[model samples]
Target chain A: MPMWEESSLVRVVPSARPRKLAKVPFVELADGRLQGVVSSGSDISRVYVSSVAAGDFAFACRTNNNRPCGGLRGGFCNHVTALVGEAVLQYGGARVARYLQAETAEAADAAGTAAVPTAQQLTAAMSAVRPQQSADGQAVTGQVFSRFLRHLAYLELPATTAPLPEMHWFPTAGAVA
Target chain B: MRADLLAAELPDLDEALAAVDAFDEVLAGGLLRPQPAQAAGLNALADAVAGSPIAALVAEAAEKAAAGVAGEEHLVALAAGRTALFGAVHDAVLARVDEATGRPREAAPPFEPGAPLPVNLLASARAWLCDVARAGWRGMDHELAATAAPVVSALLPSAELRRLAVLLDGFAAELAASCPGRTLEQIPLRRWADLWARGMLLTQPGAIAAAGAAAESAAGAASTALTGRLLPLGVDLHEHATGVQAQVHAVFEPADGGPARLVRASVSAPKPDTVVGAGAWQLLRPHLSLLAAAGEGRAMELTGMPVTDEGDLLWSDDRAHVGESADVFTTARVALPAVRSGATAPLDRHPTRIAEPVLVEGYTVDGSGAEVAFVIGGERLAVDTGRVPAASPLTPQAVAGSRACVGLLRWDAGRFRLQPLAVQSAAKSKAAVAQAGAWAGGTSDKNAAKAEKAATDAVTVLRERAGRLLRS
Candidate 1:
């Protein structure tokens, strides 16, 4: 028997509440960008595919038809905000913060007391200091939407205990290897 | 289709079993090639059951299955196809195919002349288990032997059932050996009893249906919103012949003045070598942040959590958020007094289950700490150290006059014993009040440096053992 190390035991700290992200259905950290698909609020038929580069905060939000979002003027739009929030919800706030290179220092609240910054707060802190940047997210938008559509397809599957050929990679408990 | 009509259409048991084996072999091969689409065995099976209602669906399913893996989102497509296929076969074909006793079912006689008709074997197994839990295995050795007699006698004797009987007999002998003052073997007696119980349950007439129902309930059942303070007790790792299982034990005190429940999150790896190199804690890094919060004894909120029948929390799609940190000292002081004395009773909900979680507080360590017993209200409960091979024995110096301890109460060596997971101690000075996290030396991060060194030492021991083996 060996004693466990202190680093392995992580002590958690309180952070801010996550922003609502129901508009965004898919979010992922991949290809050096935080990218996802966000459905349009007003137009039920439309969706916004968005991306933000890891280090530079370079962002893009365009519809599936290559139409650019009007909310990308000086900073991140609501779609991008929803994307980051959902990304935080899916991955931990710490992991998402690290991926986006967002600073995680404790920010002072209105009462002048120290408060632990969440992923959203960290991202906001980074955006406040850096100059606005943009990127062409046209190529990755199609890939993200395609993946989202595939995710939706899982719902169509009928309920059964039979082993799926593709699910062989995911082991179930009590399964005989 | 009607049962009589379907039975007429069905192939003999041998043919059906052969077909199923062939299909299973193909599945086991996974994505590998060399086998052709639409295997001959599958076609033959379809032809043999052509008169059945689902023969066409079976053929279609077989063809789609034989086709090689698909593009992105292959899992969804494959699942839909497999579900439809299995549903058709199960409802129409396999339902009538009696693989166990075969068609024209054997008229096996009852073990006793006046044995209960349509015997509830599962209920019998459950009652027997409840008795064994109340009394130690040795106390119930006679009942354990007698319980197996009828199930074996009533069932049509097959090689499989005979082997099960032999297994039950072996367990009885082992339990009898665990008499007072006897050196007990390391074998997990409770687990063996659990296995025997499940085997006995399956020997009944409606066993398959009962099993299916149990599985369905386990998969779908979720508890309502659970708000509580969770204290991370410790982590335990065990290496089995097939793989490794690591568990995180904790005590969850519900906010609404409900009884405390022991929460356990376990991760298993069928292939150990792939995950074991980095150490068990590293393997569980994904849950590290949450566990670390609980390690400090944090107030948390959980929703739609799926708990095992035995009450250990299962980590599947459940999400928990850490809130304000709780003072572990005050919490333990308040919580310890609420727990009732004696071994934690077995849950009647799950009959064939083992693993009863318990927390024992305010126990003074007896003299000669090398082999220790917790003296609680004049009752001596020995600490079972065999389960935690890596943990150091509880020394008087470690406790430092604090009596708070939490662990699982289990039957071991002909009696019940406490396997301590976490312990607490008080500070010598009043200026610095002993924080729960600091006193959690039993499982706290303060032991990290020592843990790393121990891991290195373990590797060296393994190398030396290997060298000795080679020399031999």
Candidate 2:
């Protein structure tokens, strides 16, 4: 399927519920990772996905069954899945692929060496990302196709709320924040 | 050769003459060189062929390289050799300890019927007095002392009596007689000495003096009951809206038989204003971790409650129960089978059982209470920082990944945690990286902000220089 054909992440989040994913403030950082924040009860969640790093993850949430009310707990959840899905819909799969590539390039540079991606490779990847053809051998598009994935990844009622820490958790070791 | 000789560079002519004399002896008669086959020296040209200024500079450079550059490498090699040596030592110690102690006990054992918990208030007080008494008491194990030193250096939990009582409840009874009023309070040590020297501490001096014969007879009959023995304590602690409560069982033998002591105690949370609070992630975080590591039932001789300045039970930063002294709570940090977050290696059953501690390096906090980053097996890994007491003085700044501490690494759920039973030493913050760098290492919030900016600036400069060098 084409990059545009990649379904939106809104459907995956269980908390995205009745109204579905709230479609405002979808942010893509300088590094190409995307995030969509949502509020379930008093618990504000950052549904984040990185093409390069650990992709499709939840930061702080009110309801991760195994862990306390914050952090990247409960590895696989609707909120994290939803963010990645939404990003796919907004930026297209091509953009995600590009982000991942760029991140890899940066990492390579940091480690003292990096290979430049060839134009032919880029074009080949771009071509392969297209949607499959219809019955008439034409690209499939402009149809009322819908996507539905049943998931109970979010809260049902009174959202899980625990106190947030005074400071945020960031990996700041050698360099300052 | 003539020009080089004329430029011979010693400030003193006497040194030059001495050099010439030595060269003449070597060339003419082999006086300096005992072997006749040695290369002949030019004695007549010795004075004229004095070494050049270049020779002096070359000699100086050679000396500098040996003392400065080569010496540094030598020191590094020495340290590496020492590290390998110590690793072997560590392995040897564990091997011996494991062989002697028949290792590998179930961490979270299956439920068994046993005795109820007792709230031994004197245990905590006397444990505190153990510190007071440690100064004079001769029974301390100095070898074992090194093991518990890492974590204790930063965070020694609790200042109030209630906290101590909750942890080591069995102490006050032993320590009470030493106090002036014979109460479980922090009293002067002088009074304890006065009472102890008279041998009035056990039972009563008056009774012993007056009824010597009767006392001896009674003591002989009651020796079995009075003899000091360690009773296995199995306690289950839970946190609820009301407060923390513990179901303690003092198990002796025979599973079906009744316990030696049965007791019930209600534990209240700490005062809200003091650091931890109810409903706060900080409070729930450590509990979740401990529960994962040891599960419910805990077996240890000592237990402590997290108490406030006023001795209120603290559940979180803002929530706690108002309680009087002698309240029971379970927040004691267990020494064995330590938990390390994000570890890949299988936990050695033998390592945790050893009472003696190995040296642990300082660590940086990952904030979520799960991840504590440190270098182990030569790689920097973030592991779970297991079960730290609320009152323990651990700080993010001090325990940063950049610094080093001494402790053991424990693993749970595939994560390694730094179980710093005792702290060894911490690095000198920015002074470690650079002395003149404009980084302010402070404990305050403002200083934290400044340090960050300085770090960024430092990185930017470094990157720019790197880019320039790379391009060149």
- Candidate with top lDDT is 1
lDDT tens digits by residue: candidate 2, B86-156? 22333444434333223332222232222221223323222233233222222222222222222111111
Judged by DockQ cut-offs, is candidate 2 incorrect, acceptable, medium or high? incorrect
User: Which residue pairs clash in candidate 1?
Assistant: A1-B390, A3-B451, A4-B448, A5-B448, A6-B448
lDDT tens per residue, model 1, B198-264: 3333333333222223334555664433456665555444432112344555556776778765555
Q: Individual DockQ of the candidates? A: 0.01, 0.03
A19-120 per-residue lDDT for model 2 (tens digits): 123332222221212333322334333222211121321132222211223433334234434544554444443344444342333334546543434323
Give Cα-based local distance difference scores for all models.
Answer: 0.42, 0.25
* Location of the lowest summed lDDT over 10 successive residues in candidate 1 chain B: B344-353
Q: Give the lDDT of residue B467 in candidate 2.
A: 39
TM-score of chain A, model number 1:
0.68
Q: After the best TM-score superposition of candidate 2, give how far the Cα of residue B16 lies from its true spot, in angstroms.
A: 77
Q: Candidate 2: misplaced stretches above 4 Å?
A: A1-124, A127-130, A133-153, A157-177, B1-408, B412-472
